[model samples]
Target: MAEQALANLHTDSGMHGRKAERFAVNRASRILSINPALSGISIRSCHLLDISRVGATISLVTTIGLSDHYYLNIMGTANRIGCAEIYRNGSRVGVKFIKEIDDELLHTIVRGDFFTAAI
Candidate 1:
C-alpha cells in the first residue's frame, strides 16, 4: 500500500542485490506498560504469538482496536519507543514494531534468560 525503499545499498557485488534478514521470536507476552505521550491507551496482558522487527502478533483476552499510532514501552526498554495498531483475528491482536528493543534486555530475551526481575 505504500512505496518503500526497503533498505540501504551496500554497493558490493555480494551485498548489492540483497536485503537484510529479520529475526522473529514468538512467545506468550503480558502487557508491561505504555508510553505516556500516546493516546488510545488501551492494552492488557495477552498471549504474544509472534514477534519480528516489524511488529508482533498477539491474542488479547479483550478487544483493543487498531491504528498506526501510539508509543509502547515494550519490556521496559527506555529507548524503545513505537506504535502498535491492534488487529483482531478471532481473539488475536496484531501489532507492528515501531522501535528497536534495547541491547541488554534484547540480549537477555533472545537468550531465553529469565530471572525474578523486580518490576
Candidate 2:
C-alpha cells in the first residue's frame, strides 16, 4: 500500500526517470513560488531530505503541484537559491538548482550546519 501511494505521487508529478548523485540530509526549508497572474508569491513549508551541488530532494508538508521553477529558502540563512523540479514521489520531490551554489555554502549545507546562523 505504501509503495502504491508513492508510485501514484511519482506519476502524478511526472517524475519517472532521473540520473544524479544525491547526498543524504534532513533540514527544514521554505518553498517559494511566484504567480505572474496574481503578481504574488506563495510559500510552502517542506523538509529537505538530501542535497547535492546540482539538486536536492524535498518532501512537502502537503501535496501541491509545484511550479517548474521555484526558490528554496534554506532555514537559518538569508540566501535563496533558484531551483527547478526534477522528480517526485508522494510528498517527496527532487529539484535541481538553477545555478550552482558556491563550494563554501555547499559545504555548510552538507555539514548539517544549516540551522546555524553563523554562515
Candidate 3:
C-alpha cells in the first residue's frame, strides 16, 4: 500500500536506518528548475511532508517530467537545497540532499519561522 511505503520511507531510523532525525514539516515549497537547459527551469509547487538534515519527503500534484536531481526551494526562506531523487510513489517523492543542512536551518524550517511568500 502507498501508506505503508511512505511509512517505510519516513521511519524514525529513516530510509536505511540513518542517523538524522526527521521532522513532520508539511510546508509548502517549490521545485526550482529541474532541467534549466531544457526549458529554462520551470517552477513546480510541492509540499514538504517531512524533512531531516539529509533528506525530505515531498508531495506534488504529479511526478511527470521531474528530474533525478534538482533544487528544492523552501517556501518561507531563501534557502535552496540540492536534491537527488531516491524514490517515488504516486504523488510523493523521496530525495536525498546533496549536502546535509545545518541543524539551525532545519530547526527554523520545522518551527515555521521562515518568511513564506504569497502564492
Off by over 4 Å in 1: 1-28, 32-43, 64-81, 102-106, 113-119
Task: Return the clash pairs for model 3, or none.
Answer: 76-115
Report the number of clashing residue pairs per model.
Answer: 2, 0, 1
Please tell me which model should have the higher TM-score, number 1 or number 3: 3
Clashes of 3: 1
Q: For candidate 1, lDDT tens digit of each residue in 90-111?
A: 7766665565445555544433
Q: Give per-model TM-scores.
A: 0.46, 0.72, 0.77
Question: Which residue pairs clash within candidate 2?
Answer: none
Model 3 lDDT on a 0 to 1 scale: 0.78
lDDT of 2 at 11: 16
Name the regions of candidate 2 deviating beyond 4 angstroms: 1-21, 113-119
Local distance difference test, each candidate: 0.45, 0.70, 0.78
Pairwise TM-score winner, candidates 1 and 2? 2
For residue 6, what is the lDDT in candidate 3?
Answer: 28
Q: State which candidate has the highest TM-score.
A: 3
Candidate RMSDs in order: 10.4, 8.5, 6.3
User: TM-score of predicted model 3?
Assistant: 0.77
Instruction: Report the lDDT tens digits of candidate 3 across residue range 1-119.
Output: 22322232334435467567666656889998646657577789999988888899999999998888889999777999999999999999999899989988887887672233212
